[model samples]
Target: MPVPGGSGREFNYPDVGAGRDDVSPAGYRSLEMVRELGTGDQIFDAASRRLFGWQMHRAAGIRLARSTPPPAPGVDVRLEWGVGPIRASAWCRVVDVVDEPDRRGFAYGTLAGHPESGEETFLVERDTDARVTARITAFSRPARWYTRLAGPLGRLVQRRITQRYLDGIADDQW
Candidate 1:
């Protein structure tokens, strides 16, 4: 299924549970690019940084899977760009699997992050026109060393990284 948001780029996931599935997060469909904030990651009244974010619009399907499916517990995930890459691997455990009448199928995962990701997935719904939609939530505790180094701009720095990621996605054709 082509995620419906941008251009309904076709995507397919096969034998997702045979092993670890290398599904693209962007393929979850209806991945609306919201917004990126912060001037310098300031957590106070004002931020020194400004970045992109989402306003609101119709959602749609996305292409997010490899050309071929692998076996179970054998997922290889990587996000590559100019910065380098964020490679994460995990044994996937499917959460909820459902195909609804609203023109959407939902599938969440228990093996999210690296060796230590929690639980997350897309409810996978569609709009009146059948555009996909879902939310992705991510949380991380402050690193003690990094937090101390931040002193003040810790949040701003974090926001910067996020901004970069969002920019990459928006600029990317995929």
Candidate 2:
């Protein structure tokens, strides 16, 4: 669980950069993308199953040091990204879940000593028309100064990763 004011071993709930703050330019930024994938409940179910099974992380090439599938709120997870010379790691905890009639998914945020600051939510939904869509929404800012300096380049990388996430959940069969 996150601690107030973001103290030691504690992350921020709703995540520090997750659009709750609006006063600062460097405060937060949000991105949302929705892609059509299959149809009906099965589509949502497939994406939900993939999400909980840690397949999305696999698709993103992220390695879970302590693998815990089927994320539920409050589960802590350690993640490693990149390979060989370039590597980054972080400890995060799942903060929210969406299990409503229209949507299903969850969100996780970084812990106290993470390299980046933010929260991201993944959702799979079946609309009234029976069209299923997978959507990702992220609000983030760099915790490290170097990452903050990267700016536009960082955004480009994020964009690619977001697309990859969309691709990861695009299923032909429900």
Candidate 3:
């Protein structure tokens, strides 16, 4: 079966790929995070590789239940968190991929089963100074009752995970 609320199909939320734009859609929470990973082409390349390969999610303690390698547009990915029976799963589809001379990353939109309805973009950029920076942008709103109940806690968790994504690139242990 096809993923519900997916790209070319349907998204759980409207304004698909809004995360990449400067304006956040109305009635949704917006997030933008930037962190300097390091300097040089080597670090930029490594960070890009990790982000595309899903290593950032792994490093952030999220289980990559399934994903299409290299994260191309239309690719589906299932991510899980928590443990055992308590595990929560989020399904999404890659809506767009950034492959520019100075930037590399992709954006995925929430599917039907996702707790939140929206899109998130991850980009690794290298400036003229060769300083590598990681940027994560997202716009979302709770889709499930539990997430809605989470209220402020949900935002906190999202921020924490976003930080871990940057830390994953900065640390580069893997």
On the 0 to 100 scale, the lDDT of residue 147 in model 2 is 76
Show the colliding residue pairs in model 2: none
Whole-model lDDT values for every prediction: 0.29, 0.72, 0.86
The TM-score, computed over Cα atoms with residue i paired to residue i, of candidate 2 is 0.82
Worst 10 residues of 2 by lDDT: 16-25
Model 3 scores what on Cα lDDT? 0.86
For candidate 3, give the lDDT of residue 88.
79
TM-score of each: 0.30, 0.82, 0.91
Cα deviation in Å at residue 6, candidate 1?
A: 32
Tell me how far the alpha carbon of residue 22 in candidate 2 is from the true structure, in angstroms, after superposition: 13
lDDT by residue (tens digit), candidate 3, 89-161: 7788888999998999999888886899998899999999999999999999999999999999999999999
Top-scoring candidate (TM-score):
3
lDDT of 2 by residue, 1-174 (tens): 554422236784444434323232346777778888876777777887887777777687778754465777777777778879798877777778778887788887777667667887788888899888888887777777777898888888877888887777773355
Residue 102 of model 1 has an lDDT of: 38
